[model samples]
Target: MDTKGIEQMLSVLRSTATQASGNVQESGPANAGGVDFAQVLQNSIDKVNQTQKQADQMAEKLAAGDTSQNLHEVMIALQTASVSFQEMVQVRNKLVTAYQDVMNMQV
Candidate 1:
Protein backbone atom coordinates (compact mmCIF):
# COMPACT_ATOMS: atom_id res chain seq x y z
CA MET A 1 0.00 0.00 0.00
CA ASP A 2 1.33 3.42 -0.90
CA THR A 3 0.48 5.30 2.29
CA LYS A 4 1.98 8.47 0.91
CA GLY A 5 -0.24 8.34 -2.14
CA ILE A 6 -3.31 7.79 0.04
CA GLU A 7 -2.29 10.72 2.24
CA GLN A 8 -1.91 12.99 -0.76
CA MET A 9 -5.31 11.93 -2.06
CA LEU A 10 -6.90 12.68 1.31
CA SER A 11 -5.25 16.09 1.43
CA VAL A 12 -6.55 16.94 -2.02
CA LEU A 13 -10.09 15.83 -1.07
CA ARG A 14 -10.06 17.90 2.11
CA SER A 15 -9.07 20.99 0.14
CA THR A 16 -11.78 20.33 -2.43
CA ALA A 17 -14.43 19.92 0.27
CA THR A 18 -13.50 23.25 1.85
CA GLN A 19 -13.50 24.94 -1.54
CA ALA A 20 -16.91 23.63 -2.64
CA SER A 21 -18.50 24.61 0.67
CA GLY A 22 -16.89 28.03 0.46
CA ASN A 23 -18.14 28.67 -3.07
CA VAL A 24 -21.74 28.90 -1.88
CA GLN A 25 -21.39 32.42 -0.54
CA GLU A 26 -24.71 34.15 -1.03
CA SER A 27 -25.00 37.76 -2.13
CA GLY A 28 -28.78 38.37 -2.14
CA PRO A 29 -32.20 36.77 -2.43
CA ALA A 30 -32.35 37.60 -6.10
CA ASN A 31 -29.34 35.37 -6.68
CA ALA A 32 -31.29 32.32 -5.39
CA GLY A 33 -27.87 30.82 -4.74
CA GLY A 34 -28.68 28.15 -7.31
CA VAL A 35 -25.99 29.16 -9.76
CA ASP A 36 -23.21 28.78 -7.25
CA PHE A 37 -24.59 25.49 -6.01
CA ALA A 38 -24.98 24.22 -9.55
CA GLN A 39 -21.47 25.24 -10.45
CA VAL A 40 -19.96 23.42 -7.49
CA LEU A 41 -22.08 20.33 -8.06
CA GLN A 42 -21.23 20.35 -11.74
CA ASN A 43 -17.56 20.53 -10.89
CA SER A 44 -17.87 17.52 -8.63
CA ILE A 45 -19.93 15.66 -11.21
CA ASP A 46 -17.30 16.33 -13.80
CA LYS A 47 -14.65 14.82 -11.57
CA VAL A 48 -16.69 11.67 -11.03
CA ASN A 49 -17.41 11.54 -14.74
CA GLN A 50 -13.70 11.54 -15.47
CA THR A 51 -13.11 8.72 -13.02
CA GLN A 52 -15.93 6.72 -14.56
CA LYS A 53 -14.43 7.24 -17.97
CA GLN A 54 -10.98 6.12 -16.90
CA ALA A 55 -12.43 3.14 -15.11
CA ASP A 56 -14.33 2.18 -18.22
CA GLN A 57 -11.19 2.28 -20.29
CA MET A 58 -9.32 0.24 -17.75
CA ALA A 59 -12.13 -2.29 -17.65
CA GLU A 60 -12.08 -2.56 -21.39
CA LYS A 61 -8.40 -3.38 -21.37
CA LEU A 62 -8.81 -5.85 -18.56
CA ALA A 63 -11.70 -7.53 -20.32
CA ALA A 64 -9.58 -7.97 -23.40
CA GLY A 65 -7.30 -10.18 -21.24
CA ASP A 66 -4.29 -7.94 -21.63
CA THR A 67 -1.49 -9.70 -19.79
CA SER A 68 0.80 -6.67 -19.81
CA GLN A 69 -1.52 -4.70 -17.54
CA ASN A 70 -1.52 -6.03 -14.02
CA LEU A 71 -4.99 -7.31 -13.14
CA HIS A 72 -4.59 -6.23 -9.54
CA GLU A 73 -3.85 -2.67 -10.56
CA VAL A 74 -6.84 -2.57 -12.88
CA MET A 75 -9.16 -3.97 -10.23
CA ILE A 76 -7.89 -1.55 -7.64
CA ALA A 77 -8.48 1.36 -9.96
CA LEU A 78 -12.02 0.17 -10.65
CA GLN A 79 -12.79 -0.14 -6.95
CA THR A 80 -11.30 3.25 -6.21
CA ALA A 81 -13.40 4.83 -8.93
CA SER A 82 -16.53 3.06 -7.68
CA VAL A 83 -16.02 4.23 -4.12
CA SER A 84 -15.33 7.77 -5.20
CA PHE A 85 -18.52 7.89 -7.24
CA GLN A 86 -20.49 6.51 -4.29
CA GLU A 87 -18.99 9.11 -2.00
CA MET A 88 -20.00 11.81 -4.44
CA VAL A 89 -23.58 10.52 -4.39
CA GLN A 90 -23.58 10.58 -0.60
CA VAL A 91 -22.25 14.13 -0.61
CA ARG A 92 -24.95 15.20 -3.03
CA ASN A 93 -27.60 13.60 -0.85
CA LYS A 94 -26.32 15.35 2.25
CA LEU A 95 -26.25 18.69 0.45
CA VAL A 96 -29.83 18.28 -0.73
CA THR A 97 -30.93 17.33 2.77
CA ALA A 98 -29.23 20.39 4.21
CA TYR A 99 -30.87 22.63 1.62
CA GLN A 100 -34.26 21.16 2.42
CA ASP A 101 -33.72 21.72 6.11
CA VAL A 102 -32.75 25.32 5.53
CA MET A 103 -35.81 25.94 3.39
CA ASN A 104 -38.02 24.45 6.10
CA MET A 105 -36.82 26.88 8.77
CA GLN A 106 -39.48 29.38 9.85
CA VAL A 107 -37.09 32.23 10.45
Candidate 2:
Protein backbone atom coordinates (compact mmCIF):
# COMPACT_ATOMS: atom_id res chain seq x y z
CA MET A 1 0.00 0.00 0.00
CA ASP A 2 2.85 2.34 -0.67
CA THR A 3 1.67 5.57 -2.30
CA LYS A 4 5.08 6.08 -3.89
CA GLY A 5 4.71 2.94 -5.97
CA ILE A 6 1.33 4.13 -7.18
CA GLU A 7 2.79 7.48 -8.11
CA GLN A 8 5.58 5.84 -10.10
CA MET A 9 3.09 3.71 -11.99
CA LEU A 10 0.99 6.77 -12.78
CA SER A 11 4.06 8.57 -14.05
CA VAL A 12 4.97 5.63 -16.28
CA LEU A 13 1.45 5.62 -17.71
CA ARG A 14 1.63 9.34 -18.32
CA SER A 15 5.00 9.02 -20.06
CA THR A 16 3.65 6.25 -22.28
CA ALA A 17 0.66 8.39 -23.20
CA THR A 18 2.95 11.24 -24.12
CA GLN A 19 5.13 8.97 -26.28
CA ALA A 20 2.13 7.42 -27.99
CA SER A 21 0.91 10.85 -28.96
CA GLY A 22 4.36 11.71 -30.43
CA ASN A 23 4.85 14.50 -27.93
CA VAL A 24 8.27 13.36 -26.79
CA GLN A 25 10.96 15.99 -26.97
CA GLU A 26 14.02 15.40 -29.15
CA SER A 27 16.04 18.46 -28.23
CA GLY A 28 18.59 16.70 -26.05
CA PRO A 29 20.01 13.31 -25.19
CA ALA A 30 17.27 10.79 -24.47
CA ASN A 31 18.80 9.95 -21.12
CA ALA A 32 19.72 13.50 -20.20
CA GLY A 33 17.59 13.25 -17.11
CA GLY A 34 19.82 10.40 -15.94
CA VAL A 35 16.89 7.99 -16.06
CA ASP A 36 17.40 4.77 -17.97
CA PHE A 37 14.34 3.82 -19.95
CA ALA A 38 14.99 0.12 -19.58
CA GLN A 39 15.37 0.41 -15.83
CA VAL A 40 12.17 2.41 -15.54
CA LEU A 41 10.28 -0.15 -17.59
CA GLN A 42 11.69 -2.99 -15.52
CA ASN A 43 10.77 -1.20 -12.31
CA SER A 44 7.22 -0.62 -13.53
CA ILE A 45 6.80 -4.27 -14.44
CA ASP A 46 8.20 -5.30 -11.07
CA LYS A 47 5.84 -2.97 -9.29
CA VAL A 48 2.85 -4.43 -11.07
CA ASN A 49 4.03 -7.94 -10.29
CA GLN A 50 4.54 -7.07 -6.64
CA THR A 51 1.11 -5.51 -6.39
CA GLN A 52 -0.55 -8.57 -7.90
CA LYS A 53 1.41 -10.92 -5.66
CA GLN A 54 0.45 -8.92 -2.57
CA ALA A 55 -3.22 -8.94 -3.54
CA ASP A 56 -3.13 -12.67 -4.11
CA GLN A 57 -1.54 -13.23 -0.71
CA MET A 58 -4.08 -11.02 0.97
CA ALA A 59 -6.96 -12.87 -0.66
CA GLU A 60 -5.49 -16.20 0.40
CA LYS A 61 -5.13 -15.06 3.98
CA LEU A 62 -8.72 -13.89 4.08
CA ALA A 63 -9.95 -17.17 2.61
CA ALA A 64 -7.90 -19.06 5.19
CA GLY A 65 -10.02 -17.54 7.96
CA ASP A 66 -7.55 -14.96 9.13
CA THR A 67 -9.64 -12.73 11.35
CA SER A 68 -7.10 -9.91 11.27
CA GLN A 69 -7.48 -9.43 7.53
CA ASN A 70 -10.33 -7.08 6.71
CA LEU A 71 -12.61 -7.97 3.80
CA HIS A 72 -12.74 -4.40 2.56
CA GLU A 73 -8.98 -4.10 2.48
CA VAL A 74 -8.62 -7.29 0.49
CA MET A 75 -11.25 -6.15 -1.98
CA ILE A 76 -9.52 -2.82 -2.38
CA ALA A 77 -6.14 -4.45 -2.89
CA LEU A 78 -7.58 -6.75 -5.55
CA GLN A 79 -9.13 -3.85 -7.40
CA THR A 80 -5.93 -1.87 -7.25
CA ALA A 81 -3.95 -4.77 -8.64
CA SER A 82 -6.44 -5.25 -11.45
CA VAL A 83 -6.31 -1.59 -12.39
CA SER A 84 -2.53 -1.50 -12.32
CA PHE A 85 -2.34 -4.57 -14.51
CA GLN A 86 -4.75 -3.09 -17.02
CA GLU A 87 -2.76 0.08 -17.17
CA MET A 88 0.43 -1.86 -17.78
CA VAL A 89 -1.21 -3.78 -20.61
CA GLN A 90 -2.33 -0.56 -22.23
CA VAL A 91 1.17 0.80 -21.99
CA ARG A 92 2.58 -2.32 -23.59
CA ASN A 93 0.10 -2.08 -26.46
CA LYS A 94 1.03 1.52 -27.05
CA LEU A 95 4.71 0.69 -27.07
CA VAL A 96 4.15 -2.08 -29.58
CA THR A 97 2.22 0.22 -31.84
CA ALA A 98 4.91 2.86 -31.61
CA TYR A 99 7.55 0.34 -32.48
CA GLN A 100 5.62 -0.87 -35.48
CA ASP A 101 5.11 2.63 -36.68
CA VAL A 102 8.81 3.30 -36.44
CA MET A 103 9.74 0.12 -38.22
CA ASN A 104 7.33 0.70 -41.09
CA MET A 105 8.55 4.18 -41.77
CA GLN A 106 10.57 4.77 -44.97
CA VAL A 107 13.99 6.15 -44.17
Q: How far is candidate 1 from the true structure (C-alpha RMSD, Å)?
A: 8.2
Lowest summed lDDT window (length 10), candidate 1: 1-10
Q: Which runs of model 1 end up more than 4 angstroms from their true locations?
A: 1-37
Q: Report the number of the highest-lDDT candidate.
A: 2
Candidate 2: tens digits of C-alpha lDDT, residues 18-64: 76677985646764664445776788789899999999999999999
Candidate 1 residue 61 C-alpha distance from true site, Å:
1.0
TM-score of 1: 0.61
Q: What lDDT tens digits, residue by residue, belong to model 1 across residues 10-87? A: 454454455555665344685453234445556667777887888788889888987767788888878878887887
Among all windows of 10 consecutive residues in model 2, the one with the lowest summed lDDT is 1-10
